[model samples]
Target: MTVLNEPATLLNGSAWTSHVFLGEWTPGSGGDYAVVEPATGKELARLGSATPGDVGRATARAVDAQRAWAAAGYQERAAVLRRAGALWEEHAAEIEEWIVREAGSVPPKAALEVRTAAQECYEAAALASHPVGEVLRSEQPRLSYSQRVPAGVVGVIAPFNFPLILAIRSVAPALALGNAVVLKPDPRTAVCGGVAIARIFEAAGLPAGLLSVLPGGADAGEALITDPAVRIIAFTGSTRAGRAVARLAGEHLKRVHLELGGNSALIVMADVDVARAASAGAFGSFTHQGQICMATGRHLVDRRIADDYVAALAERANRLPVGDPSGGQVALGPIIDVRQRDNVHRLVTASVDAGARLAAGGTYEDLFYRPTVLADVPLEAPAYAEEVFGPVAPVVAFDTADEAVALAADSEYGLSLGILSGDGLKALELAGRIPSGAVHINDQTVSDEAVIPFGGTGLSGNGSRMGGIAHNLEAYTETRWVTAQSELPEYPY
Candidate 1:
């Protein structure tokens, strides 16, 4: 267990050393990969790439045990998930530490995820036990009932950002519905997510082959996706990668749920509190170094408020504490790697050269890029059109309601959008008109459960991961209607 040793050799869930070409965590195979400390140029863990063989074994294990698991009644499934939830609550501290270390998240942010996973487990357990379809009323003596059954074995491909939370969003629902999960975490930060799954499943007394985590990169993913035994695929990653999965899954006619890229916007109106709105908007765009899919990338402010709001936002950006992610006061940490830092720097430079104004930071020091805020940014600039997965937020001014809505909705990726306005009525109006999957009024966009339906219309993703009743229905469901007649007709047409 990870609680026993922080530097323990990474496990492939079921065993210690990897058995290559079969579901195992082989050390140094596909490519020599290293887990780096985001704040420092230090290597914490070295891993080998997951070969095709590893994927075959993992998929086989999940497929082998899927039928019996699906046969297990909802009551039994709920009971197991309840135990897993209790265990997750008990080991929150340990899980949080691993998450922060491997994923580069602040301790506080990581702790919340541990709590969130437990809550999702409980909610999924409740959802699993409840009957999905209802009885219908008819004139003829007939019976009708619908069942929401598991989609057989599920393959989860988790991302680096919010590993545990993102992983749990799908896995818990899969488990509660009595589906076996073969999770392939982001190779760079797999330990934390893998450990959490291992601990929860063990505590829940799940059958050995019912759940397993294989930490691998592309080769591993390709193997799993191609396997015919895998009935369902849940992926969270880039649009390019998501497209590949969609194509591959289409050929096989396998079910897939994708949560892909984002180039979201934040629109601030003239009536809002300039100072507070600027601060909130800056944080939303730059938080986690802007690596998250829901992170705000585009900024649209009313022309009357643009200049003053930009100044306030710059000042607020300067106030953010920068240092190690593990510290208490540090709100901003270094980017995940030098490659991302260089990419972000290039994006900022191109924006400035293309006529965007640098309102605040637009410089870099090694892995840390200063929190950048750009003004007078045009949609023509590359930064304006693409998803900038970094700390730079480009701002553009708008005068009319039509102009403001047009600027925010201009991006091809429509993941999430935030709005700030004093007039709640106007804010709601704007929210309704925005083209993205979710809209926030008088505040920055966040992954809220009860309030918004989080997702996108086009390049952002094909499906929503978490939200309200629709999300629950989408995750684990199959619809079929039955028509019955009490008086049987003897004549056949």
Candidate 2:
């Protein structure tokens, strides 16, 4: 383990210890909120909270700054983004410590988050040099083309789980495409998500007021979405919250992108190695305490090998170490907070009462919950039906491929799906039948890359992806048709 550094020191040794980073660190009007360490239930720091008025002020400044940012040359923008990426990598260790302490992530997960965030910046930097649009044929004897233009100010609201990656996925691309951003990060993980991002960009030579970090509550989030200056909204969180955001953004006629909740499934075939498949299942369901949106919520196993698979998964679950991440190395860390822990426990208890066999664990010590495995989980079981969002794996047996497909497709969420089989073609064939944003063949549900298009279908998202050059351009910019002719076009007057 490495020595942990204070966030204020890690943030470029500035006096930005305040909560809100709106151009500069200023005391917010929403009063102060305690930044708590979930692992120890201790107060890590006290920071000012942003109110709705602060959100408005941030948006106003962003709007003013966006014009100049958009006017800057592409190379200048790219340079800023590239420098930010280097800064993220340069401060990886310090950032990881903040994530572990503030976001309750284990060391490895924290490192992955930092790496992914850096990759996001690097990928976005490339977008600055990508072709903006296409030339089209016109019928009126004129040269016509369409070009991509910035969407002015973008409002980004991110969740606590995988905070840095989720927020940067949108922020970097938007900034690279010449759009200013007003961010509202979950107050629980604001230091890692909001302040860290602001520091990196500030050090990378981003002009002041182009990005604003508001560590705030729902009021601030709502204000960001409703602010007329914010023309685009990028939100990642639960489906319930997404619906509200979408509704409000729609009313304002603003373009919005959502990456919401998911109850994804992983299918296991009888032909593969039971232990190996079980290992994949455990990783899919237990990584970062299964708090990811793409976490495998339900396991659909072939009936022939269901029993063996369940035993193997339970064995893996039982051996996993659970404790505070900051204390030492542990396989699993504490849940985000008491409310989330109580919900996870409620779902587990209800599932057991509904006849699901508790194969391994169904207990916790404070916020540290043991990795749990439940076999013979009925379709109607609460844990199986809902998004557990915890270290709970519920297994259900399917007799045939058709039954497996049906079981896997039962959820309202179509975020991600996984298929495990010895035959590649068979797995590919099964994947085609499932309508998810991402399908992993012979792999787990939890996966992401900087260049890949990532989002979901149905309740998972709004059919808008956050990665890849084309997708990023589409999300952060709009297309405009322009025509050129030597002289004014002749028309019947």
| Tens digit per residue, CA lDDT, model 1, 315-378 | 8777777677766567777787777788888888898899998888888777777888988886
Residue 406: error of model 2 in Å? Answer: 0.7
All candidates: TM-score: 0.90, 0.97
Q: After superposition, how far is residue 391 of candidate 1 from its true place, in Å?
A: 1.4
Task: For candidate 2, give the lDDT.
Answer: 0.91
lDDT of 2 at 125: 89
As for model 1, its CA RMSD to the true structure in angstroms is 3.7
**Model 2, 119-154: lDDT tens per residue?**
999988899888998999998878899999999999
Best by lDDT: 2
